[model samples]
Every structure is written in structure tokens, then in C-alpha cells.
Target: MPRTEVPPVLVTGATGRVGRVVVDLLMDAGVPVRAVTHRSEAAATLPADVEVVTGDLTVPESLDAGLRGAGAVFLVWTVPPATAPAVVERLAVSTRRVVFLSSPHRTPHPFFRQPNPMAVLHADIERLIAAAGLETTVIRPGMFASNAMFWWATAIRADGVVRWPYGAAETAPVDERDVAAVAALALCQDEHAGGDYVLTGPESLSQAEQVSIIGDVVGRRIAFEELSPDEFRRETEGSWPRPVVDMLLAAWGATMGRPAFVTSTVLDVLGSAPRSFRQFVADHATVFIDPTPSR
Candidate 1:
């Protein structure tokens, strides 16, 4: 089919870390793009060619406009589960396929097997999508590399010393851009229907090692100070949700002796090696560096 005749892929979470990249990749490939955002102001952040529409996942009726002529939907569920069935039902009626951004809860690794409310939510949503019978692909990306910026950038920028628990716990932090690329491919091609992929970085690195990689990129030797799980909890008590802190502590503690679950899925699907942790840090080195100080 010609580009003009291609039905737009409606992207939920259109301004998010992954969905925004998915929007751009789809547009680059000549597929028409329809982005769904809760706030209409988010349209200014997207490409001018993208058809931005207002939609809220919690209110399934609000999605009708964006789903009206969409061929596929990139579903990013960050809301409560109350309306998933209704939303999936609407997608089944309006779109031919859906690419859901989910987590690797079913992976048998000890790290992934920990009790996670988010995982339960992801599994429930997956079941709903299966029941809906839309051509579906599940993209599960382990630890996003950008999380380094979220978790440690403040400390790194301040003093270059990270105080956190489970410094030796290992994980392969996948790049969001790579995750988005695979999602775009799945959205544009019918062959990816029913495909399930778990994406990870090229190598497994410990939390301390990940910090060191960032330090290396920024030309500084960052100190890694391990905190007891209790100390971490106390430190982040009011700032971070209790459940999230517990979940991370459990996963990291469980995987302390084991290497992270690494995968070749990114290479298998994209025909290129996934970006390494060092490369990811290099690309965003400025985030880890303090701008006010001279290097």
C-alpha cells in the first residue's frame, strides 16, 4: 500500500519516553501517525506531521476520536485496571492491531519473579488484549538505561557519589530508543502480530558498574556507596512510593549472586546489536555531568 493509503497508528502515551520515539520512527517509515495525549498541549512537543488527538485511557469513551480510523494502536498502560477491558474492546472495534508496552514479569529469572503490583497489572492487561483478539505484540523492556539519569543524575551532578543498595546486583538496561524501534516495526508489519519479545542491553552490568560507566563517560570517578535496604527506604520515604522501593530492593537483592537475564531479541528483530551501557551513557553524558563545574 502507498504511504498515503496507510492507516495511521494511534500511539497512546504519545509524549512518554517510549511512545514519543515510536511516533517519530513510524512517521520516518512513511506510516501515518496519530498520537493520543491526555493534554492537548503535548501536541506541540510532537512532529508537525503527527495527527495529535486528546484521549484518556481511564475514560474509554475519550479514545473514540483517535481510534476512529487507526489501523493499529501502540498501547502504553500507566493507568489503573478498571477500564482496560472497555478500552481493549474499543480497540478491537476500531483498530486491526495493537502493540502493548509491557514488562517481563513472566520471564523465569529470580529478579523478574519478585512480587510486583505493576507486573500483575501488566499480566492482567495482556489477558484482556488476548481476549479482545486484536493482532497483538507484547514488548517487554528490562531496566531502561535512562533510569540512571532518573535515579543517580542528581547525586552525580551534585557530588558524584551514589548511595544505594545492591550495588552488585546486575541488570541489562535496554535503551528506550531500541525498544521504540522494535515497537514501530511491530506496529507497521502484520508479520509481528502475536509476537512477544523481551528486550535488554547488549551486556549485563551491576548497579555500581552502571554508575562507573556513566562516570567514565563524564571523565570522573564516581563513588559507589552501598546503603542497606532499610536505609534506602528511610532515605526515600516521603519522595518515593513504599511499594516501588520494596519492589526494587527485592529484585536487586534476589539477583545479587546471579547475572542479569540477557537477550538477543533486539539483534534478532532489528538485525543489529543492541546498544551497550557505555554507549548509552556516552550518548547522554551531559545528564551525568555537573554543568556549573569545569571538567
Candidate 2:
């Protein structure tokens, strides 16, 4: 008998942080991958074996080429929620399974219970998937460890002091690679259909402690200076979006007195411990270190 051929898995947001990793994992597992990107030039960064197609989530019709003959889809929704219904409808007709990258908003933890537009978007997409009757698995990851690089890398590189709010607030920062691995597993295996997994890191660490860990990795002393929420808002008024700043402030304020919500879903799904915050920092130390400094 001839060998069975696996249908390609379509990956949206193929150039994104988590989606890029998912594409690599699927390719490494000998699974065919079809990556959808808005910019044609972005496809050049993906592995040579991937079938890259141009698609925009906002315009649902653009996804037809990428969705054709795909068995499963890894959906990463970062765009606005205007065209989600049409997109979900298209996916229902095009693919058999979908793995959605979501947040742990449904978790009974104060950190995740804040007023978040992103959570609202995720919930709405989940409902859309359920109504469309597509085989789906939702991967909810809490506080990505890579957020440290986005939140503090520039400040750490500029000076040894990180001026930020909620230094005492604790969170278990899940590794993006772990999230991508679980997503890849769900996309490839039929057993994960309808599975909902909330992924977190191995341990909880406060904002200050996380900064200290980065300092340890860089072999220097970095100071954590807590800022008032209003001060933070003023500092980021022009540069950051108003809603995002408010969302972070609300979450941090709500979880100030409590430990972060931690889960073993990564270990349960991948059969290995989730990467620690220190490990994440150690691996990306160059981002936090400046090469040239004035005396």
C-alpha cells in the first residue's frame, strides 16, 4: 500500500512570535505547513519547506488560497474583531480542526479577571468557533515570558533601572515555545479536538524578582523602581495605546496581594516542565545588555 499523505496545516499570523515557532515545530514533526501572511515579504523569513500564501484576516476572502486542502489551522487572532464571523465561517468550510491561541481570561484568577478588550475578543471568537461546529482546541497562555523583553529590554539596555508599576505583582510567565508546542500537538492530533488548555510557567515570580533574574543573567545589578499607575500612564501617554495601559494597570492592581495562577498544562501536554523565567532571561540576555556605555 502507498503511504498516506498528510494535508497541510494552515497557520495564520505566520510571522508572529508564537506562530513563527508553531510553523517551525510543525515542519520539524514532518507535517506539511501552509503559512498565511499579510505581507508577501514576511514569508521570506519562514522555513523554505513551508507553502507561503498571502492572506489578510481583515479581508476573509484572501484566506481562500491558504485554506485550500488544509487539514487543520493554527489561528492567531491579533487583528480587530470586525470580520471574525466571516473568517470562522471560511475556516469551518476549509479545515477540519483549529487550534486557537487565546488568553487565560476564563481562569478564576484576579490577574486574568480584569477588564480587557483582548479577552472580550477571544471569547467572541470562541463562540464563533463553537457555532461554526469546527473541531477546535483553545490554547490559553498566561503572561508570556517574552513580555519581559518587550516591557523592559530597552530600559535595561539604556540604564540599570527599570521604572515600572506593580513591582510586587506576581505572575507565572509561560514560555512562548511551550505554548507553540502545545498548539502544534493539537493541530496534528485528533485527540486534542475540543481540548482547552491553560498554560503557565513552572513558578511564580514578582515583577521585581523577574527584573532581578534578568540582571543575574546579564551579570549586573538592575534596580526596580516602582511607579504610580498614574505616573506610568503619563509616561506612556503618547507612545502607548490608552486601552492597553489601562488593561495592564487593572490586572496588576487586582493581583497585587495574590500569587499568580499557575498550571501544569504544559507538562501534562508536552511531558516536560515549562521553561522558567530565569531560563527565558538567560537565553535572551543580549537583548537586555548594552554594548557601548559612556564612562
Compute the lDDT for candidate 2: 0.94
- Per residue, candidate 1 scores C-alpha lDDT tens digits across 171-251 of 999999999999999998899999999999988899999998888888999999999999999999999989999999999
Question: On a 0 to 1 TM-score scale, where does candidate 1 land against the true structure?
Answer: 0.97
- Evaluate residue 222 in candidate 2 and report its C-alpha lDDT on the 0 to 100 scale: 96
Q: Model 2, 252-280: lDDT tens per residue?
A: 99998899999999999999999999998
Model 1: residues >4 Å from true position, as ranges? 1-4
Each candidate: RMSD to true structure? 1.4, 0.9
TM-score of each: 0.97, 0.98
- Among the numbered candidates, top TM-score falls to 2
- Look at candidate 1 and tell me the lDDT of residue 85: 92
